[model samples]
Target: MFLDRDGTMIDEVGYLDRREDVRWFPWTIDAVRLLNRAGYLVCVVTNQGGIGLGLFDEPFVHGLHAWLDATLHESGAVVDGWFLCPHHPRAVAAEMRGPCACRKPGRGMIDAACARWDIDLTRSWVVGDRDIDVMMAVAVGARGILVRTGHGERDLRKVDLSLPAGTPVVMDLMEATVLILAEGERRT
Candidate 1:
């Protein structure tokens, strides 16, 4: 499964550059564990535009992800991979100073994950709280579920009409997990 990091899995903290600023939702670990136990290669694909804007660097993001994994490991929940797009159209950082395909709504991160793991897009799913997150899945024929946490509610007001009719909009990660698991069962 593909998950969005900020907002979708954890609290939306504007630009999380420090580990101390991390605030996970109550059910985040449990939901991730559920997916992990169910044989899903859970990957967190995020758009960390802060790196491009000089708010933070890539090392900080990696370290923070490592810290998160260690914390999540306590509950037997682990993210298989952490992928991010650290680019923006107007980036201050030279390296990040251009739009990249890795950004959400783009397929670079998804492609990177597939290259590293034996992922089948047709059977994959993306759970996030934004329209771009859902569209990420749609780009590859994977299922997209929008969770009503973080920016989900506000962004819900202007979802792309091009998305499939009745694209799932759930309460949170747990709800999305339940729906995904049920769908998996149905498929089998």
Candidate 2:
């Protein structure tokens, strides 16, 4: 499964830079463990414009990720990998200052993960808290689930009309995981 990090795993702290500021969402570890047990890769795909906008550097992002990983490990949930797009069209960085395909609403990161991990996109899932996450899943032929955490509840109104009819929107990660697992069991 591909998951969005900010707003999805951690609270939406508006481009969080410091490890001290990391506020992980409730039930994150248990939800991740459930997906992992269900044979999902549990990778993270996130957009960090703060890096490209000079609000924070790549090292800061990495440091925060490292801290997150360590914390998850302590809780018996491990993230498989993280794919981030640091570019923003309006605000560019000196090095990261260009249009890149790794951003969400684009399928570069998802495609790259599929290639590297031999993921079956058609059978995989994307869980996020934004419309961009839905667009990413649509681009890659995966199922997109919007969780009402972070910015999701607020962003729901902005969702487009093209999503599959009756696509489920859950309250949080744990509930989403339960639904996904139940659906998987039904299919079997």
lDDT (Cα, 0-100) at 21 in candidate 1: 79
Model 1 root-mean-square deviation: 1.3
Give the Cα lDDT of each candidate. Answer: 0.90, 0.84
lDDT (10s digit) by residue, model 1, range 40-153: 999999999998888898899998999899999998998999999999778976668666789889989999999999899999999988888888999988989999899988
Error of 1 at 149 (Å): 0.3
* lDDT digits (tens) for residues 74-161 of candidate 2: 9889788888888876666455766678888899888878777888888888898887888798889988998889988988776454
Estimate TM-scores for all models: 0.96, 0.93
lDDT of 1: 0.90
